[model samples]
Target: ADLQEATVLTATAEFLDDHTVRVSDNSGQETLIADRIFINTGATPIWPNIDGLLASKHVYSSTDLLVKDKQLKELVILGSGPIGLEFASMYAQFGSHVTIIDKSSKILGHSEPEIAEQAKNDLEEDGVSFLLESNLTGVNDTLNGVTLTI
Candidate 1:
């Protein structure tokens, strides 16, 4: 609520010194300098370097999936991390055929082994398919759906 009432400045910030920084917008406005500043940058999805992946119209990031309100029939997720697993579970519950592919042998490679295994089992029981120890080599956009090469 407090943030909504505050005046927001959309600008690029550049550090002038150790304690000062300059903020300027695209419009030829005068740059404002602040003695103290806090940086709050958000995160973006890092796509892998794969042949014809970026050019495909069917490809979507985790962020993209979140904001999309349309229902999907088939979804082929390329990663088995938290984002991929969560989306798989959500989409499966919504009646979408979800397929998750990962290069690692196990799902949730960064989490505890037992926990990851349990989660993977739960997702599988919910009708989400897992393709482990596989790498996505290519992606092709089809008229009906996107085809992924694993």
Candidate 2:
């Protein structure tokens, strides 16, 4: 919102000793006379702590890769929860060559076993590879494109 719409109205002022009145600004940033002050910066996505994970250019966040790419030859999804599977399904439908990896033994680990199996079957039938009980050890750039070492 425009600060021009705001007025310097006094909130519940607290006077410490005789000299100072604490102030509040409704719109956000605050200031004090001395050099000491605290400023807050809000949220940013936390990248996984995998080694060399941040250095690669082809490495894209779930937001960028999922929403932007209509089609791709292959995908290596790192998680197998609902969110990761959802992305896998959407991208696979969009004709991405997809692969999903997780440390758990089953794809839908929390779901009913039979249902999860059926879902896994459907996904595999549609060409999504499930790498279960696996760990992503490293990532390497290959001649053709990118290779994810799991």
Candidate 3:
């Protein structure tokens, strides 16, 4: 295979020059300088610039939720994009009360209306709630859980 001759590294990379890069993992025990590099732009969670969101200890990114061991009783998601809807469906199946709040009036805005409606109905049948055309103004960490000001 083409990758048989490749020296692959799973680490953070810093471009030192046009053809050179320095790569190291969190341990900092091993570092490598490579003249040739192939970039794989993987998905990363983005924290929106919403008030009290970054400061709240009760909030977790999608990445954090993926590795989380504790089961949640209730969940609130901020988007209706593919990734968000996928999470909503998954969490709802897990018996978590899932709510998705989006600024848009409809889910799957780019897809056909019929298909979108069916998807929404399917999610709703599985006990997922949608708050359309709503903006989350802030997040507050409560004694019980998190509260969103919409």
Candidate 4:
């Protein structure tokens, strides 16, 4: 395998110049000068500026939901995009009561209207609900779960 000969280091790299980088890890730091350099910047969740959202312990991002071990009996997802629909479908099939709220009038705005309608129908058959043309005004974290003011 070609990857066997390549050096692999897991560290934060700071680009110093066009060809030099300062890499740091828990052990120490090292300066590397290479003809070619690659950087893999992973994804980070973008939270809305809605009130009580950031402070709520019940709120979970897609990444956070991945590591969460708790079983969610009810779920309210914000958005009807590809990722949002994916979560809604998966969770609904998993026996969770999933509801998707979006500002748009329809789901899968980028797709054909007929296709989108079919997808919505399929999701509905799976026990998923949709709140279209709705806006999330605020959030409230109760003893049971987080509540959304739409």
Candidate 5:
């Protein structure tokens, strides 16, 4: 808990040289010597050539829906890629009504057809809904709490 608190403190640094630094915070300023700085912000998600889709609430990047809120009984999910489907499975198992939309006619495209079919059936048995071969025109239906128009 102490480390977590320390990690949240904001500090300003003035570099004296490659190995020397100055730090300022609420307590005041100080100079110190350091060997290196490491940055590990992780991967970036890139979407190429899709217009106006970013503004649609229906278009949730892999990150947004990761934290499942059980109180939300209905979920309209976009995409059937690993990331999207993984969340779908997790949420459905937790008892949310999950609807997944995939542009391709067959989901899990790279997998064998039978494997994909079986997996789809399994998820269906678990009460997950899918709208395959559907192009997301927008998100406008309020009837189901959420819906992706094709």
Candidate 6:
């Protein structure tokens, strides 16, 4: 494949000058000079500031949930965006009790109302719960599970 023949360097890239870039990895460092350079930095999940949430060991970002192989019985998602709803749907299909809380009036606030309602209905049929106009006030990690106060 073309990818197999490509030279891929996994490292932190920094623009040294207009035509130079510095890449550093665990192996060593390298300076690459080119007329044009492209950067493809990925996005990271942003965690909200809720009381006791930062201190809780059970708190996980969306990315963390993707990489982890834990079997969850109950999941409390803090947002109702596309990513959050997707996770809710997946977990609900996996037989987890999924609850999604959002500060808006409905899920997928940026999408068309009818489409969003249809998606919400489908998720609800799958046993997903939604708490609209709700804000997470605190979090408590119990011995058996984590409790979220919304």
Give one digit per residue, the lDDT tens place, for model 6 in 36-114: 5534343467778889998998988888887869779889898888788878977777778999999999988888898
TM for every model, in the order presented, reads 0.69, 0.62, 0.69, 0.68, 0.57, 0.69
lDDT of 5 by residue, 1-150 (tens): 112221433588777888887789999987777675322232334453444566545455556565534345777666666566666776777777998888899777877788678778877987899999887665543544444456
Q: Write the per-residue lDDT of candidate 4 for residues 13-115, one digit (tens) a residue.
A: 8999989999999999999998855343435566888898888888889877767686699999988877788778767776789999999999988888987
Residue pairs in candidate 5 whose N, alpha carbon or C atoms collide under 3 angstroms: none
In terms of TM-score, how similar is model 1 to the real structure? 0.69
Question: How high a TM-score does candidate 4 get?
Answer: 0.68
TM-score of 5: 0.57
lDDT of 4 at 37: 55
lDDT for each residue of candidate 2 in 27-136, tens digit (9 for 90 to 100): 54333343322221223344677766777666777667736734577788887766677678767776778888888999767777986787788788878998899988
- Model 1 clash count equals 0
Q: What residue runs in model 3 are displaced by over 4 Å at the alpha carbon?
A: 1-42
Q: Evaluate model 4: give its lDDT.
A: 0.83
Comparing 4 and 5 on lDDT, the stronger one: 4
Q: Give the Å shift of residue 86 in candidate 6.
A: 0.8
Relative to the unseen true structure, what is the C-alpha lDDT of residue 58 in candidate 6, on a scale of 0 to 100?
92
Stretches > 4 Å off in candidate 1 = 1-43
Stretches of candidate 6 exceeding 4 Å from the true structure: 1-43
In angstroms, the error of model 2 at 40 is: 32
lDDT of 1 by residue, 33-135 (tens): 5553434343568799999899999998888998989989889888877777878977888788999999999987878898788888888998899889999
